[model samples]
Target chain A: MKKKLVLYLLFPISFVACDNPAPEKKTEKIHLEKVNSNTDILAENPEIKLVGSRGFSYDFNDERFMQFYDLPVKNLHISIVDDQQHIQRLAMDLPKDKEAVNTLKTQLNKAYGQPGEDAGNDFSAFEEGDVLVWKGKDRLIAMITSKDFATAAKIEKAPKIDILFVKPEETNN
Target chain B: MNKLYTGALLGLAIAASSCGSKKIKIESINNRQQLDSVIALLPKTQVKVDSIPVRVLYMHLKGDFTFYGQPVKEFSIQTKDEQLQACTFDIEKGASDVLQQLENENGTGFKEYSNPILSWSTLPKKIQFSVQDFDGDLLTLSNKEKAAISLYFNNPVNNRITNIYKEIPPVTTTNDYQLEVDNSECGYRLYVNDFLVIDHAGARTLGVTADINPYLVKGKQQKVTVELLPGNDYDGNPRNRLHLESVVHVALKKSSKRSMFSSVVFDFRTPNADSMVREDAHSSRYIRASKFYGQLSAKVDHPFETDAVPYELPCYAAAVTDIRTIPDAKEKILAHYRKLQQAYLEKDSLQLEKLLYPLEKNLQTAWYWSKPIDGQTRWTNIMDKAREARDVKLEENVVLYTTPDGHFAKLLPAVYNKNPAFYLSKEDGFYPLDYYVNIDKNGDVQFAID
Candidate 1:
C-alpha cells in the first residue's frame, strides 16, 4: 500500500517538473565591416552628435570630436530607444575620399565576409551588386552601400551617408 | 532541513519591508531660537525627515537697518513617480511673519527678486506662516528663495518697545528747519522727495547735518517723507513697527534772476559765521534749511538758465592739470600728430609708447573710423595698442574731428590706409590708444571708458 502511494505521488511530481523549463536568454547580433558583436559597445559608448539635421555636411576643423577622424564623416544620426537615452542605431556619413572609402571597405570585408552579392541592395539584405550586406543567424543584418571610386582630395561636392540598417526581426531579442 | 531553512528565510525577507524612501527637509536661518522650538514641536521620524540646519553666519552691513525675514529652507516630499507632494508648516507657539515668495507682476517667477517682508497687522504674531505653491507639483525653489523663507516666529525673543516716540513734528516752516525727534534705541532713514538723505545711527537728538541740495532742482519744492528702520524688525514683531513722521515742505524765497549753476553743493551743517569768511570751496549752496534730530539738511538752488552738467571723470579741466589750459586744442592735436610721425619714422618704440596724453576723469572721446576697429569696455593702455600696430607710419591728410567745445579732437590717418587705422584720441595731447594714457589734471592716470 505504501509503495502504491509513493508511486502515485512520484508520477504527478515528475510530470509537473517536466512541464516547466527555464527560459533561455536571447542575444542580438550586430556586425558591420570590421565591427562585430556591438551589443556591449553600443551600451557603453556615448552617442555621436551633429548640430545640423537639414542636410549632410562635415568640417575638418570642427573641434566637437577630438578622437574621431576630422575629415571624412559628413554627418551622423543616432537612434535612441523611446525617450530614454539608450542608443539603438548608429550611422555615419562616409568620407568623400576614395582612399578612405577603400580602407573602410577592407576592414568591412574582413568582418562581414566580402559584402553580399545582391544587385542594388537598397531595401533587401540579399548578396549582390555594389550593395554589400552580412546576415546574422539571429536575423540581424548589417548593410553597406559603396559608390564609384573618387579621390578623397579631389571630391568636388560634399556627400551624404544615406545608407541605413534595419532589424530583420520585429522583436529585438 | 537546509531547503526548509532557505524557504523560511525567503518568507521572512518578503515580510520585512523598509518603512519609506522619501522625506521632507527644512532649514532654519536668522531666528534660530524660534526655528528650533518650532521644529522640535513638529513630528519627524525615520521615514519623515524634517529639518537640517546648516551652520552659516550671514554677513551684516555696518549701518543698514531693514529687517529682512530669516530664510527657512523647506522641501516637500517626492514620490516614487517623481512628483512633488504638498507640504505645509505647523507652528505651536512663536512670533512669526511670512516673507511671500517674490513673483512677477503676472504672478510668474521673476529673475530679479528681492526678499520682501510681509505683515498681516490684524493676525497674531505667533502663527504667521505662508504656503508655497499649494497646487503645483514642482518644488524648484532657489537657494535664495528657499532660505528667504521663515517657518515660525516667537514673540518674546524679539524684544521691542512700540509707540515710544510721542513728541513729533507738528507744523513747521521753511526757515523752521529744526526737527526734534525722541531719543530712541533705534536709527531712522530721513527721505526728501523719496530719496534717502540721512541714514543716521545716534543716541540723542543732538547736532547732526547733511546736505540735501543734490535732491532739489531750482525753484521746485520737494515733498519729504521719513521712515524709522529698526535693527530687530522681523516676524511681524513690534520692533520693525515704524511710526511715519508727518510730511512737511520748506519754501525758498524766489529770486528774479537766480544764477544757473553748473555745480551745486549743499551743507547740511549749521555753518559758523567765522568759517564763512573765505569763499566756500564747495560750489554747493544751501537755498532751503531744515533740521531732523540734531542734524540740519542744506538745500542749494541753481539758476534755471544754466544747464547742470553731470559729474564726469577725466574731464578737460581735471585732466589738463600738468600744464595751463591749452589756448588752441586743434593746434596741440596737429602738433602731436607731427611728433607721432617722427617717432614712427625713427622706429622708436619707446617714443611711440610715450605718445600718451593726460585725460581727466570722464573725458569724452571718439574714433574717426566708420567701423571703428575698437570698443573700450574698461581702461585700456594706449601703449599696448601702439605695440600691436604692425607698421606705424604717417598718412597724408590727417582728418581731425574737434570736440563740441573745441577743447579736444580725434585724429585719424588717411582713409585709404586700410591698416588697423590708428585713430588715436586727441585730448590736450595725442593719446595713441584709449583712456589710460591720458593723465588727470593731477598728472595721474585716472581714466576709464564706458
Candidate 2:
C-alpha cells in the first residue's frame, strides 16, 4: 500500500518533472484552504495557489501547458506570457462524478458563460481529447477530455471539467 | 515502472551514445586514501546531471588531500583564469564545520561556499570547449541560430546557475524577431531544440537578443520585452538547478537612441553571481550501470528466436549507380536485406563480412576498441550487444517500400522489441528496426544503417 501510494504520488511528480518545464520565476506559494471544490478555492483565494510542478506542452512546445491536478483531482493549469504573466491559456480538471461535474458546469457557466457560435453546439469538449470548451473575451477554455483510445488510455477517469484559455488570435474569432 | 521497461528506455539513449569514451589520468599523489577518494568521488557524472556522458576535464591535486573522505578539512579548486574557490557541502543540515575552521586558518582565503549545493571556480571548461567548437562554424550558421549560439557563448555567467541554450525554431527567419527560450532545466541536452521559447523557470523572467531591430515591426517606441528573474537565497532549494541568476539580452540597436527594440535592464539577480556545485555534475551512475547493469541485463535477456522469422527477398534490386537506373531494383534491394538478415541468423561469416557500411566499420573500431568486432564470428557478438539496437525481432509481415527511382527499396521492420542488452532504461522499448536498407537496381547494398 505504501509503495503503491508512493509510486502513484511520485509518479506524476517525477514523470511530469522529467518533461514538465519549471516556471521561470520563483514559484510563489499560497496554502490551500480546506475547500471542497476548486471553484470555491478560486473564489476565496485571490492569488494563484500552485500545488505541484508545471508540465510543458508536447504539441506546440510553447509550454502552453498548465497542469492543475497536483496531488489528486481538483486541479488547474494556466499558461501566461513569460514576462507579463498574462493568461495565454488556462485549463482545469475536476472530479468526473456526475454531481461534482454538475456543480462545476454551474460554476463555469456562471463565470465564463456559454460557448459562442463558432464553437457551434458541440463545444468540442471531450470529443478530440477536450470535453467542454468555451470562449471568453480574451481567453480560450478546454474542459474534460476523451480523445482516441490510445491517448485516453493514459487517464484513469476523465475529469469533470478541463478548461483552456488562450488569446483571441488563437481562436476563430 | 517495471525494471525491464525502465532499462529499455534508458537503453535507447545509452546504446546510441555507447560509442563515445574518454580516458582519465591521475598524476603521482602521495596520499593513497586521497587518491582513492578522489578517484571514487570525482569525474563520475551523477544521475541528477541528467545522466549525460561527462568527461573529466582536469583534477589538479596540491599535496593536501581528503581527511578520510569525510567532508575535507580544506578543499579548494582554482580555474585557469586564476580565480581561487573553496567549497563544502551544505552547512545547515548538521554539516560539520571542520572545513569552515580550516578555511579561516592561515588566511587560506577560503570562505563559506556560496550556493550551498553547487560551488565551482571560474567558467566550466566543458561549456568552454563546446563554445570553442561553436566558434568554428560561425559563418556557416544562419543569422538567427548564429545570434542564439553567440548569446549562449557570450553569457558565461549563466552557466553558474543554469545552462544557457539557443531556442531553435523549426524554420528560421519566420519573422524578424528574437525567438523565446525555456530557462528550466531538463535532461542531457546535446542540442537546444528540446526546450521551448519564452518558457523560462517562471513568468516575467527572460532576456532575448535579436539580430534585427524590433522597431521594424512597430516604429520608434516599443516596450522591448525585459524579463526579471526571481531573487532568493536558494540554499537547500531543490529547484535552484533550473534557473539562471539572470540572462542579458544584448540587442542590435539602431545608431541613435530612436531605434525600436531598445535596450532594457531588469536586475533581479546580483551580477557575477558565483558558480554552483552541481551534485549531479559527476557520472558515477553511468559508470556502475554501464559497466555492470548493462552487460548483466544483455547477457540475461532471453535468446530471441530470429532464425524462424519469415522474410522476402526481391529479385529486382541493385546498387544505386551515379547515372544508370537498374532493372530489377526492388528484387535486388530486397535480396540484399534478406541476405543481411540471413547472415545474422545463419551466422554466415562471408555475407556478414561484406555487409558493413564504412560508418558501421568506424563504429566497431570506436566502440569495441580493445578487441574490435572485426572477425567473421564476432559479428554475432556485435549484434548481440548492438549499441544502437536491442533484440530486433522481425515479424512475418514484411513491406518493401520502394524508392521513387525504382533503383532502391527500404525494408521496413514489421515489428521488433528493444530488449536492450546494455542500456539504462526502456520505457518505450519498441524500435521497428532502425536499419535503412538502400539497394541499387543492380542489387548492391550501397549505404545506410543496415
Best by DockQ: 2
Worst 10 residues of 2 chain B by lDDT: B146-155
- Cα error, residue B144 of model 1, in Å, equals 18
Model 2, B123-242: lDDT tens per residue? 211111011113222112221221100000111222101110111112211122232332212111110111111212232233443222211211222233323233222232223222
Evaluate fnat for each of the predicted models and list the values in order.
0.00, 0.00
Using lDDT as the measure, the top candidate is 1
Q: Would you give me the overall lDDT of model 1? A: 0.30
What is the per-residue lDDT of model 1 for residues A1-173, given as tens digits with 9 covering 90 to 100? Answer: 55543333232222112112323322222222223222223332222122321112212121222212223342344443332222344444454456665666565456445555433344344322144444443322333443443423465443333233344463233
Each model: TM-score of chain B? 0.21, 0.23
Error of 1 at B381 (Å): 17
Which portions of model 1 show Cα errors greater than 4 Å? A1-173, B1-132, B135-314, B321-450
Expressed between 0 and 1, the share of native interface contacts present in candidate 1 is 0.00
